[model samples]
Target: MSVDHATMSGLLAGLRVVDLSRNLPGPFCTRMLADLGASIIKVEPPEGDPSRPLGPLFDALNHGKESRRIDFRQPTDLDQLREWLVDADIMVDSFRPGILQSMGLDFDRLKAINPKLVMVSITGYGQHGAWSQRAGHDLNFMAMSGALDQMRAPTGELAMSNVQWGDMAGGSSMACIAILAGIFDAQRRGTGRHIDISMAHGAHAHLVLPKATATLFAPVLGHPPGAGEDMLNGNLPCYNLYATADGRHLAVGAFEFKFWKAACAVFERPDWVERHWQRGQAPGSPENNALRDDVAALIATQPLAYWAERFEPADACVTPVLTMHEAQAHPLFADAARTQPWAAI
Candidate 1:
């Protein structure tokens, strides 16, 4: 039997999710589920979600979902919530480790009521970790995961991005994966599961490639790369950002030999064609640093418009850095504007 409800027809059409989470992570997860046609019941306290004051953000995250106001202090309200859970396929929450247990909404108790409920708890740390009960946010999670340390400029200055990597990628996206996997398993075995998602742990998992590179090449390199010293980060001349004459930036991603060759042709520096990683050139070496300086100096001779026009038809893997407004109006994002309703927000 299809778990889909008759009114909808997406992948999660008939799934019912009870979202007792407020801020970003839990709400964003449920929002993605709702987009796939799941019915989301956003359970909020009488005071409402803390994000409610953030008008556009709140609308973007909670749109198309039913809102239910419940004060756990009231026995009737709590009982009503339990009644809702009886028919819920999934329950998502983002409280500290033992907050749900104190409110009598623990997984053990809820699982008895709804034997097929897939319960998911999201936190900055795992449920049983020493820092599980600690109060922290996305930045703290990124810092703890070592991912933030990698976000550095060529000058070794740490750069803070507006993108909440920990909240969205680690917490929201991981919770969605856990929910779907749990649902599949429960349908097969007729038993529910509790998923513990740590945002910091998920963020750390994204460092797999960098971690492997650091470990595998430590013997040859004498030491692991730090901050912007890694190949993909900013150490390589073939793949780095450069400033143009107008102070605008251009992203040069000519990592492969062919792309580097093409970029060198565009730069009118055919001599730089052989000074690439494929030709036994070590990144961050004295020769490579000199090559980077030469490349930067050449790029600085032209404005962003001139280089953008030059690279528009070349297979050099180079592009002008664009502002958010420019990106939104770009042709590449045309389909996004039509399909993603929240793209405007």
Candidate 2:
């Protein structure tokens, strides 16, 4: 998915950006910007943006960007930052709510430097919420937002699968989109804007489903976090995972009658379809459990490749759970020779 430099000329050709954010969310936001040809000058303090030395993401995210090492507290450094801020089309940062104000880089002050600048400020709990000053990240955000209660590890402990699931996927991803939207609005209105992106709020956006369900049902029902008891929390058989004989897995997501019948047909067990298909209910019911057992037995007879071959061609949602290595080189992506211009990585 890499792009050649020449082919990326006019995407964001003349945009100048000053990035003051450190670590994951801000850098990831800027990385997407860099990918589109924005000239981003990442400003860091004397000690440096922590992510520059944060071992993992350097080579990948910071590839096409430049850095400006300056102590924004010092008079000269402030002068230089002001110069960049005054001229930049957009400025981004991930400081806490009032820390930017304390650091003399607040949006009001900086916007005064360049009224047309689109200022994006990202924070954990947002600027003026009850948990505004509270320290938080992905796991905490997920826990608070109800996105974490559904996933449990084999040990019965709450699973925190990937770090920054909420931070990057929720927070950083949302911030980048909001920033782009602000830029578009500025382009149309002829006046730049100040965007306050709350990482917690971004994380909270993922709670729409649970929140709506809880609200809709709260009058008649109860809250979630009931584990396998909750409706959409993998409590049913038709929408759950089954373990194979070799400890591999299969995702049986036959959430509808049509898909359920297709799955049963694919497994050559049509009787199980209507018997186990509780389309509107959750996973642990007798019908779903029986179907789960059937699928478990059927899929374990062969390896993942064997199952994929039969099911993939049929467009059955029944899929062999892929490992990390298998996913990158999977056949789904091995069609470079078939596309019009052919694929280029």
Candidate 3:
């Protein structure tokens, strides 16, 4: 029951949190708060958090918290649950809409007990909508929101599934932000508020950039992948991925005209400066393909180390395409070794 005095020194230092949901978003949001020194008591429905055993990434995320995965099926524990919530400052949940209400921890009841409580509910959709009651995960949410359709490869292979594109992208991130805002409002207004978070809404929010690409810029650019077909998505001479001689890869992310000019100067490929890789054109057309091929050949002439030496000094965003393991060993990431918990975590 004692708090870690030194550990609880961050901004959210004395806050007590009750995390009642499982899986990604709920845990991720609370984990972030916990990192800031909040006292988080994860209250699972007796079976433990589903994400606790989710592997390498889970180990990397779930740290600095007290977990009591006690099954609430037993009648005796509900009394203890009430005791835990009576003074808890925040409650974070991710059950689909009404599932928590059915279990009897709905905001109304908790607010009655602790009027200043901040109840955060992160669902696939929102509290009320046609799809509000629908069952979904990150992929389904993103798929319906049109966020996924807009993230396809130029060649249009299988749809990519970057897990938590919704759950973490803005769902948990937004939930955490709302909870913090609610906490501040409760302090100033002397009243609590229920935060009904919608993962679908958050996931859709992540698509703002891509969605505008289609709706806003499609007219000028002639649609297709819209802005996706623009220089950034593996379609331009100045910005794309290339293979090196040792079968390694490097990433070039220059977007601004000046940066593009710098990349050209770096490679002594000034011919690429005025090449005009306007969007909406054929991806591998004769001219574009030749530029990509030439860049590929130019990079392939040297090993990744040579390219790293070449690019690191230029401060261009150009970088070696490091494998996951290689990335951890990278000098930039390796400097973390001296930074205590960040490196350890």
Candidate 4:
């Protein structure tokens, strides 16, 4: 679990970043940059970041970064912030579209101060749109992007995800990519770029595969799959979740013919090998539903441990569903301390 920070410390050794963001998205983005050896100066409000009260989360996001208190309401403090931006390689913020302009920190003014500064503006929506100035959080962005609709339970009830997909994936991750690309381009062209990242737009972009499948089969299926009706979701017996006798779950991801065949062999249901999607078994069809029911019934007869042991040597993609704590303790995550240095502290 030991990381050679000396080797990683020079990745972005000379980079200077001014982080004017609070809470999750902006802080997470800068945290990643800091991990890659960028010097991050976290510009907090006079009262500090709102997330500071969250304890561990704040520490996890702001570790290894310098902190500076700046009151934008004060002209002198704003001037000091501008001075810092003059030599900063990157600047990140999460204000609404016109908020920074009102505070005299707009991209145009900053560009004049430092033409080579890469400015990243992360928001719920883009810089210009009807919802650009709207107040929203992760759930609102996911709902707007149709991402939430796809996360539904077997009973057709919408399930809320524990992870902040919009904030972390759409906003933070996309902003990091945009920042790196902008830095590369600025280094080449000798001019910085203002990158506008919309969490909703980025979330929508992640649905490319599902969107394509829906479009490709909408004409034949009359409508897109709903809830547990999709092939990859829960329609096929070969690729689905089954409850064990102990009430635990097993994730069966035997999508391909080879894996499905191997899983069928493990279940002693060799006859079910050919009843697969690749062999013309239409997902969610009556035959597939019957096969899924049979498989589920069989799986329910055994405990999760039995299946886990059975599948340990099987080539099938079957795996026992472990709780978060169990996953953390698993050997797969044994080196987590190396990547999450703050966890060790």
Candidate 5:
């Protein structure tokens, strides 16, 4: 892909960022900063960032920035890095705790060199914790945080996700938000602060919403429904995926009464409307499974395109389950695709 650096513009136009991170999370965070017009100087090790060999993804994340390959382990290289940090506004790294400190790039050391530098350290656990020293990745973090348990399939196997929740949402997104906040705080206080980000902690934080609901319903429900046994996880007829006659799937998000009623009307199954969440009709219950089977059978009578057209004017929350290619080609994403951060790259 061709990069048009001039097209990058944002509020952080004059901000200077020194990226000492590699792989997905740190690079993703720095990319966001670069997109917002920060002057990102991506300092690569002598061997270069690992993502450099990842082809299109490398261009997608590291484009629109200045890259310098330096081996900080060498004395002269370390001196050069110190030069880069002397006036840098922000510094981000993804090494485990104490690693950077050993390299003399710790917060206090960097702060002494540049008082206004916002230093962000992204890790798997945190700076000081029992699990901080352990090695982990996105799957490990998600699994340890119980998020993976909630994503189990009908056969009790964990479903692989298309996106890395721990890396992207937990590490990258959290780091981006903290870096921005750190920048504000540094300017206001005339000093910078160290931002410690734990990918596992961030992943666990996302469980707040559904966890609260599960806690609230636990006493009455015996236990919150287990994975695919829950309403929102495909056990309920109103909120699930259905296979069409053409072997394509459709997503049904009619959890609310109005939408569920509309869907029932469309299926000529008005009797199933009021049966929603009735006694003995809890998700995965015999009654619920029977209703799900009935609904699935009805859905299988028509092809995906037929259902798509039939529900076009209906208020039912029904839509086709599109493939990634189809989604990118769809009109709904035309504007987003055109304005995406990687568009110019």
Candidate 6:
């Protein structure tokens, strides 16, 4: 049977999500749920969501969701919020541990009104931690979780990435997954569960690469080498970033042996094909460093456009580093860039 994906009933079509969280994480989670056809009601304070001033980001995250302004301190507004919660399937909040309870919106109280209500609390630490009440942002969480430690440059200096790994990937992404799990559990068990998402802990969970390679390097090794230390971290010539003649950058991620062989062939360095990671050459060794330098110099001989054209039809992993504007205009993301409002069920 043929099915139309756009016209089909969405996975979360019957779900109702009430977002009390502000800023990025909670709002982003609800936005994703809204995309999956869930009805999202974003309850804001009298002054509105703190992220409202962020312009494009606010519009992107809060679109297709209904907004209500309420003062939690006011009895009338609290009563109105209580009414809204009675029918909500999921509730997301980012307040500190006791803040919601202080506002008389505790899990137990809300469950008494509606037992199947899935409550998700997103925080910097967690519900039962000493740092639960501490205020922290994306960089703070990444720093606390050792994620920032792994982003060192070649000279052992820590590099700052513009992407919000902790806030968006760790916090928001985990919260989304947990909320869906909560929804499934509520539907099957007829009882909702409280989801506690700590942004720092979530970021820590994403430190998988370091943990996987822990045995390779001793803990006594004071500051572990970050860049150019491991195959995935830019040690190998075939899987690193290179600069073009025009000062533009190219990311060559030919990690597998076959792909690396293909890339070597494309670069007219057929002799380098045998120098794979498992070829008994230790990562970041003199030989590997020499190879990396050779690749960099070779790439720099040509402009970005030249390499882009050469690698376009080739199966080898090579791509030009693009700015945000360029990425948005790319044909691959053309469909995704047209952010439509959540379709009606």
State which candidate has the highest lDDT: 4
**Ten contiguous residues with the weakest lDDT in model 5:** 335-344
Question: Distance from true position, residue 217, model 3, in Å?
Answer: 4.4
What lDDT would each prediction earn against the true structure? 0.90, 0.73, 0.75, 0.91, 0.85, 0.85
Q: Give a tens-digit lDDT track for model 4, residues 130-213.
A: 889898899999999999999888778998999999999999999999999999999999999899999999899899867887
On a 0 to 100 scale, what is the lDDT of residue 134 in model 3? 90
Error of 6 at 238 (Å): 1.5
* Candidate 6 TM-score versus the reference: 0.93
User: Can you rank all candidates by TM-score, best first?
Assistant: 4, 6, 1, 5, 3, 2
Clashing pairs in 2: 235-283, 235-284, 236-282, 236-283, 236-284, 237-283
Better of 3 and 5 by TM-score: 5
Under the 3 Å rule for N, CA and C atoms, how many clashes does model 3 have?
2
lDDT of 2 by residue, 1-345 (tens): 553444543477778888889877888878777876799998888988776676667656666789879986787878788887887998888877888788787777877778788988877777896888888777787777666775674335687776676778677788878878988898888778888887766776776666665565455435543454434555555666777667787787776777877877888886676664354443445665665566677788877667667788665578888877786577664555332222234
Q: Per-candidate RMSD vs. true structure?
A: 4.2, 4.0, 4.9, 3.0, 4.0, 3.0
Q: Check candidate 1 and list the clashing pairs.
A: 4-14, 5-14
Which parts of model 2 are misplaced by more than 4 Å? 1-10, 153-156, 212-225, 230-232, 276-284, 331-345
Candidate 6 wrong stretches, greater than 4 Å: 1-9, 219-223, 336-345
Better of 1 and 4 by lDDT: 4
Task: Kindly state the number of residue pairs that clash in model 1.
Answer: 2
For residue 88, model 5's alpha carbon misses the true position, in angstroms, by 1.9
The ten-residue window of minimal lDDT in model 4 covers 336-345
- lDDT string for model 6 (164-282, tens) is 89988789999999998898889999999788999999999998877776557534344454665754777778788899999999999988888888788888888998887766656
User: For model 2, how many clashes?
Assistant: 6
List pairs with backbone clashes in candidate 5. Answer: none
Sorted on lDDT, highest at the top, how do the candidates line up? Answer: 4, 1, 6, 5, 3, 2
Better of 2 and 5 by TM-score: 5
